[model samples]
Target: MFAVGFGANHFIPLLQVYREGMASSEASLTAMVGVYAAGLIPALLYFGRLSDQIGRKSVLMPGLWVALVGTLILALGAFSQEWPLYLGRIIIGVSVGMGMACGAAWIKQLSTDDPVAGPRRATVAVSAGFGLGPLISGVIAEFAPAPDFLPYVIHAAVTLCALWWLRAAPETQEGRGVGKRKIVPPVVFTAAYLLAIVAWAPWTFGAPTTAFVTNPSQIGIDSAFPTLVQGLLAFLTMFSSLFIQPVVAKLLANGPRWLALAALGLTTTAAGLGVAVAAALTGSVWLMLITAPVLGTAYGIFMVAGLAETERFADDGELGALVGIFYSLTYLGFFVPFLISMLVTGAENVFGMDPTQAYVGVLAVGVVVCLASIWPVSKAAGYGGRS
Candidate 1:
């Protein structure tokens, strides 16, 4: 699961390198990521259900195999610098979709010792992978030869180790029988889910696109710096999730407060991103780094909070279905950048703004969207209830 995240996100900062190194169009750059989400969304829905019947390891090992292949393809793409990049991303997306859906469920089932232990470990593994992937890629891309090629090679090696671990791991779902299940959205998951989804949108989907759209290269920063900055964006967002989970757990120990905290997380992400955008507009790497802790904390808080809320609404029969649905919705954030890239292009042509300015405009709009939700989210969280 951790390797899945590592491979999935490691390519984020490399978008800049691909753009400049190969002279790829901005549209193609964003499309690369968009197509990934396109592949992942469907795979999540399909595979999560499939795992129930076939057992966890059946789904998990294959997913890791596919991920290993996908990583190799990505490395080849970096070497060849052509359609392979697109193909690699789509393949990786599919692999991650399977890995995340099945791997998380597997972790939960195996954690019979403690209920909370499963989620905590799974979240940390994934979050740490998400944060470190880009940072690892960026460091290699910055300092090493064949920057693009080398990073994927390292990831491929890591994927092999994951495969080995999965093979040795025990199968937790033994007595369960395979049955067909439909992914109907739960009734209890209404406005609250929507609010959480909205709150999560900015970071899960918005951050990477915003970072690349406001490309530091446009403002005369070295090519490597943009890569580092983009990596930092991911590093902070995910790492914060890892670091802050325990704190969030302690803070929201009672009631349905996680939903409210999720809302607050989104609100903070919006505000912090606004400052980060301003920093981007000025080509100030320092300012961008400053915003990392805030973004990371928000992601950590909102993600766990939202998950806690979702767990409450799930019935045992359809717990996996609900988890699948929740994740599928959140993963929609992956495509947000692609759509924003298109909008940024339009804004450049129609509004006469540079990429940085257009990104700032988009981010400012995001802030408004997040701000508007606070009241409703608070209300849903029973803000005025017995304190």
Candidate 2:
């Protein structure tokens, strides 16, 4: 899970390199980030079912090889090639989607001795990968020789070990082929689940992503080491996510219901967006940095809450599929940057707002959207309570 996740987000900080090295357009750059979903959603939808049919080892081992292949593609792409980067990102997404389902499932199986710890550890492992990958790669990209290529080399090296490690891990699932059970779980379409899909899921990645990638350039940050700065923002957000999970666990220990956790997480994400608004308006890079952990806390809360909800709602047969759904929705947030870029350009042409002013409006709208979600989300929680 950690290695796959490292491959997943390691490409993010390199966007700056692509932009500067390849002279990529903003639209194309943002597409690279959003394009991850293209490969991820399909894998997410079925890898769960695939893992359920085949053993976890069968799905996971191949996924690691795919991850290394993706990283190598990225390294090659660094030689001023644009299409390779995009292709690499798509491939990385597929591998990540596989790991998200099967790796997590395998971890859960291994931790059968301690039921509650499995999900927590899985979350931590991937999230830590997400944070550190960018941090290390960003630094290396900033100062090391072959900035673009070296980071991928490091990641590929680490991922190679994962292949061996997972080889020794026991297989959890049998190749049951197709049972009478359905692939798409019923709970996913329920009103309670729909609330997460609509309201909570998008912002799961949206908030933290907006913090690091989207706003940094728009807010007039002219750092000497752009990659490092981006990496720090990502690092801060993810590490904060890791630290806050324990707090969330304690808060939920009393069983205050997932609704409160969802509401608070979304609302806090809104507040972070609100801060982002201030940061952009004032052109304060430091203020922008402050928003990273705030948004990340909300991200952490949502992750814990989302996984807990999956456990609550899914049967053993449907767990992987449900996990896939949860993550698929969150990956949608990757498109937030692309959407923001498009909207800002459109606003400049149609609404007659400058890019900076237009971006501020978009962020402000995000704040409102998050705040508004509280009611519907709570209603969903109410449904859960009633049932």
Candidate 3:
């Protein structure tokens, strides 16, 4: 799971590399990120359900190999073209989507005796992978020989080892899977369940997308390393949850489940407002610095709460399918930066505002949506006993 995830977003920090090398426009560069969700959504829908029927390892092995192929494609075409990067991003998404759905179910079953620890362990693995992928990719690109190609080669090597390691883990689902599992979980049809996803999932990635993708570009600074600022922001936002989630988990253990989710909604609302402020203000680089951590904090809380809640909603046969559905919704936020760019261009042509000037209203709408999500999101988690 970790290795697959590491390869998934390692390309984020290399935005400058692709932008300059291929002479890609900002819209196209951002599209590379958004297109990942395009591939991920389908994989989540299909491969995750396939895991339930065939066993986790069966699906996982092939997915990991596909990830290596994705990296190789990236390495081979690093500076030579533009379309391959988009293709690589899509393939990486497919592999990571498989890891998220199947690996989470696998880990949870491995820790079957303790339900609480199961989701925690999965989130830890995922969050760590998400954080470290960009951090290492950026550093290696900054100093390593063959900057255009070396990073992908290193990631492919790590993934190869992960594939070898994966063979040793015993199959948990071979003989144990429930017969006649549905491709889609029934729980997802419930209004409360849909509300949870609607209110929490999209914004889970939205916060970080804004933090690392949009924030860095909005606040310019003089730096020798092209990827350093965005890479650090990615690391900081992801790793912040690694520390904060355990505390939030402990809090949930001691208090009501709804509190964690309520906090998620509140923190996400705060993050949106902060994003709007940063977007609207001039020379708000420090504000971007501060907002990134808050975004990370929101992401962490949602991970713990969302996973636990999804686990709670699942029956014996439905775990992987439910997890798949949950994750597919989360990646929708990756399109945010792309949308922001499109809106900025459109607003400039129609309203006669520059890109930065158009950001204010676009981000303000985001803040409004975030603010309105609070109650419904909290209510989905049984706020006031309403679930």
- TM-scores of all models? 0.88, 0.95, 0.93
Q: What is the lDDT of residue 329 in candidate 2?
A: 86
Model 1 pairs whose backbones collide:
205-333, 241-300
Candidate 2 residue-wise lDDT, 158-264, digit = tens: 89989877767877786555564566787776777787444688788988888888887566467888888888888888778999877777765565564467887
- Candidate 1 per-residue lDDT over residues 281-312, each given as its tens digit: 78776666666666667766666655555556
| Model 1 C-alpha RMSD to native | 3.4
RMSD of each: 3.4, 2.0, 2.4
Instruction: Estimate every model's Cα lDDT from 0 to 1.
Output: 0.69, 0.81, 0.76
RMSD of 2: 2.0
**Cα deviation of 283, candidate 3, in Å:** 3.2
Write model 3 residue lDDT over 113-184, tens digit each, in one string.
776777678877888878888888888877777767888888998898999999899888897656676678
The TM-score ranking, best first, is 2, 3, 1
Candidate 3 lDDT for residue 107 = 90
Best candidate, lDDT-wise?
2
Runs off by more than 4 Å, candidate 2? 175-181, 196-198, 382-387
Q: Give the residue spans of candidate 3 off by over 4 A.
A: 257-266, 272-276, 382-387
